[model samples]
Target: MLSKSISSLAKRVSSGLTPLRSNPEFWLAGTIPWLKTEQLGEKFIYSTTEKISKIALKKTSIKICRPNTLTIAMYGEGKTRGNVSIIKSEMATNQACCNIELDPELADFEYVYYFLKTQYNELRSLSSGVRKNLNSEDIKNFVIRLPQELKDQRKVAAVLSALDAKIDCNNRINAELEAMAKALYDYWFVQFEFPDANGKPYKSSGGKMVYNDMLGREIPQGWVVGALSDWIAKDKTGDWGKDMAEGNYTLSVDCIRGTDINGLNGKGAVAAPTRFILEKNKGKILAPFDLVIEISGGSPTQSTGRLALMTSESIKRFSRPVICSNFCKAISLKNSPYAFNFAYLWKSAYENKVLFGWEGKTSGIKNLLFEAFTTKYVVCMPSQHLAQGFFDFVCPIEDMKQKRLKENDELALLRDWLLPLLMNGQVTVA
Candidate 1:
């Protein structure tokens, strides 16, 4: 039952700094992964969104924390503060991170990480006064309680780590599967290699090609080139329903915002807030094959047209009818049966930075030029049969990915439910 401050258990507590961006030598041609507060929250961080040069590391206060070094966010917008993660490889962080190196003699590294995991809310509340920020002093002085025996700590950690390891494995498998699906799409659609009547890859087996003035390139016979708008059936802006049920606001829905799109696509956690709306707005409910695109809120490095493909499985993941936030639009393709083709088209456009050219700004927030993008951007539509073939092949891959996601969700639930009980000695590994 005895507890000690983190200062007693940690060998060192420190933070890193961002080097001067004005120096090209500091940022350009870098290989070292540099993390910011927004990158925290994952259990094991293997990579980062941004990296720094060795010159920056030497010239600045940044130091590469060893593997397993626990980093916590000190301050950020929204719920970015109090987020925590353990770097799986050598990495440097910004000033907003509170990095703690545990003393092997006084504490087990995994044990301490799990203990802090249960204190997320407490850590968030540590910030006080007008300037809300947690400093190194607060992290070092934070108290922790664990079994005195180091072996017992390891046992507890082993139990929790097993679940996390499984989840991590599933995520890796899912990533690989997604890559395969993308490759299949590229080969069949982009390369015009769908199977011909004889079951051979179309383009590779001397398939016919025709040149079109609109595309300024050769495409397979029967394929049509047209603007992005020709493929779109409907595009409607979303509504942010009332926060609470009252008057005509009787229907309850899970509101998906621009920030939540990637989460639905397995990139991160879905954090949509529930809202109450009028029953008459039921027509806005999202269904399978509907694509949601973010129209606003992009950063300098990112674009505003991030999308989410709605599948039957995706809809099933939500307990109630889902609605997009006002910052997004729900788009339905004109070709109902070939919806997957449009989804892949949008994805390819997004990955190629095509959305960057279609951005307009209002009040400093970047918004997608939805009308111009959908009305002017050109695309090549493959035959219905080829499109359907690609869809059939990718459906199983996506379904399997969804299954793994569901499993991870359940495993996380079990781990969270057992964490407090295990930490307090109410339950033992064996």
Candidate 2:
């Protein structure tokens, strides 16, 4: 049940103010508009790559919304699907944009955010336009059955917010873990800071250290770096490719993207079918313990060089002959001594330093050529034994992070289910 005071506030907002036509620049560009997308940050925004210019802002109308307000992306572009976000920042807008502002006193802001998120599909269905947009009238007329009291809204929002907070925390932790791993990899491999033959720094040795103009740093003693091709195996065929095409196999991106392979029980794990598959033209895919990488589309542009390990099950599933996509596939290794983790570390270093050339066409489809990655240079050989040792140390930490992600995913499912029900008064808060 909701408190009477909250219900009164809802009534005042619902019937008090008249909807007015306004320019977006007034909201997006003005002193402070209640609702704006920029506050959510790039991660949650659709097409984080797309930027809105100040000149473009001159065209749209901005609806005045309040702080902690709720707004929906009425546009139905592929990027706009399921795009429900809470406005934590202010903006001045121009004419041409349509947005609705909710009274925060009547509705809990977080609750409204979750409420709209749950109704995203419905909203999509109702939208109509060449670009699929929702008008302010449509939002004003949309019915949301809430408890009569504000207390109920708070209670409901609290529950969902807790779950979301946890998910956010988990994501942050995972990011930190990845950063830590990459830093350690760079320290030992690039800086060569590991203990030397006499427990001294590699840099202090009598070996020649010349300052490289490109890096503006001193080179290691007797150390020479080359391209990635020098280290990886050249072979591309295997039994694993066959199983993946037959729908009996899959791949995990956990090592690269930081997502986990769910529902795996034992040492023999199956790949999640979402991204991994064997292509007909490519024969005999990657095997177990094979190193694979995302060859395209990531930060630092050219070097979106993230790597992951192929599970044993993925290898068996694709055991049949088939070719993998150029964007993602196994790394060819000269020797089995180096584990996938070492390759992942090395790839990170290469990515950090390499300049990703402009690869996207004006057509909007960005293409990362495999040839570009193959030809791009990096150090090929380091002591294989040392690389393997690094992998052995980091594998446990990766496993733990994977488990936390899985748990957070399950909790998210629960929050999604509860949101709409509570908002619609189907589920009451005590």
Candidate 3:
């Protein structure tokens, strides 16, 4: 659905691609995380940690694309293909991506970035066939419309960039808050350094440790060993069959898929496709503190048990109800005190490959062995007071994370809404 104004503007503008030339700094695949999922749709990305060497760049047929360069993934699966990004630093990319070095005199880079974000689906459609890949030529000839007034373009970019910056700020805040909570979790539960009677670190201050046969180690005397099932009030994999074609279902809701759980404990503004389901099945609707785990679709390198925590504030981002996709299992905790703790536990298990033992293969895909997973996994059941203490200490931080997440959702919505309107000139900067 291309806007008439955008279509007209695209016709007027010329597009170009950086010429491929032999370079020594060629990444040669696997050298760096040359490709990314989070970087897509972002205004700027710097691969400081996953960067290619100058020698590799020199040996390969790669060009050092300049900053503010808008690029798109020329090939990949799902949303990976045709996704756009702006280079924050001079970087080299594989041929699978198309780099567009826009002329500043002709267009504002930020305005073009936002335009591409809105037209992503259409851009994606240019590629055809089973693999759905676009080539450099496809991007070279791709069109963009620029405002006659550079200030107008800047104004539009400014409005959208402000929203993006705010969202980025919130994400930074959430990352810091999550790190704080995780550090506390590791200190108290893993290191056994919980607060003691005098508000001192418990295990470090020698607060009553005892041997526990179940864990094969000494734990705080009062804690009991229990399975994850002990804390779960309800557990079930999600539904998928009820499509819009199904006469039973009416409105559609964004279905959270396995790929959507991007973070260790939760997702950050994952884009999910909508699916229709029966209103009665609203019971499957995700609630705050509900744990959504990926039960299927894992690769050898990636594990199956990816986890995400639904926040009370975050859940409201959807208009109707949000439900997990079939590949995920939603677990509602019996109590709120265990929410943050269990999220951390599951994350640790996934990261450490502890849960891989509870995985089975089906149709060439890795699946979480549900029954075995529930029965085999063990948890240290700390006293209710201790659990409550941890929750009380972290609750404010959690609340802050959710509020920021919710704000990001709103900001994204507003930015998206304004994009086409601004591009079509229905909304003006003045």
By TM-score rank, best first, the candidates go 1, 3, 2
Angstrom error at residue 397, model 2: 2.4
Which residue ranges in model 3 land beyond 4 Å of their true spot? 1-38, 128-130, 210-217, 241-256, 259-288, 321-325
Leading candidate by lDDT: 1
lDDT of 3 by residue, 100-203 (tens): 77667667778888888877888888997678777666666667765777788899889989998998888888899989988988898999888788889988
Q: Residues 60-169, candidate 2, lDDT per residue (tens digit)?
A: 34233444544455443354533555544444322223334556656665665666676667766767777666665565555565565667778888888888788778
Clashes counted in candidate 2 amount to 54
**Model 1 / residue 101 / CA error / Å:** 1.5
For all candidates, the clash counts are 0, 54, 16
Each model's lDDT comes to: 0.87, 0.49, 0.75
Candidate 2, poorest ten consecutive residues by summed lDDT = 253-262
Residue 258 of model 2: what lDDT? Answer: 15
Q: Candidate 3: lDDT of 8?
A: 32
lDDT tens digits, residue span 298-323, model 1: 88888999998888877766777899
What TM-score against the true fold does each predicted structure earn?
A: 0.90, 0.64, 0.82
Q: Which candidate gets the maximum TM-score versus the true structure?
A: 1
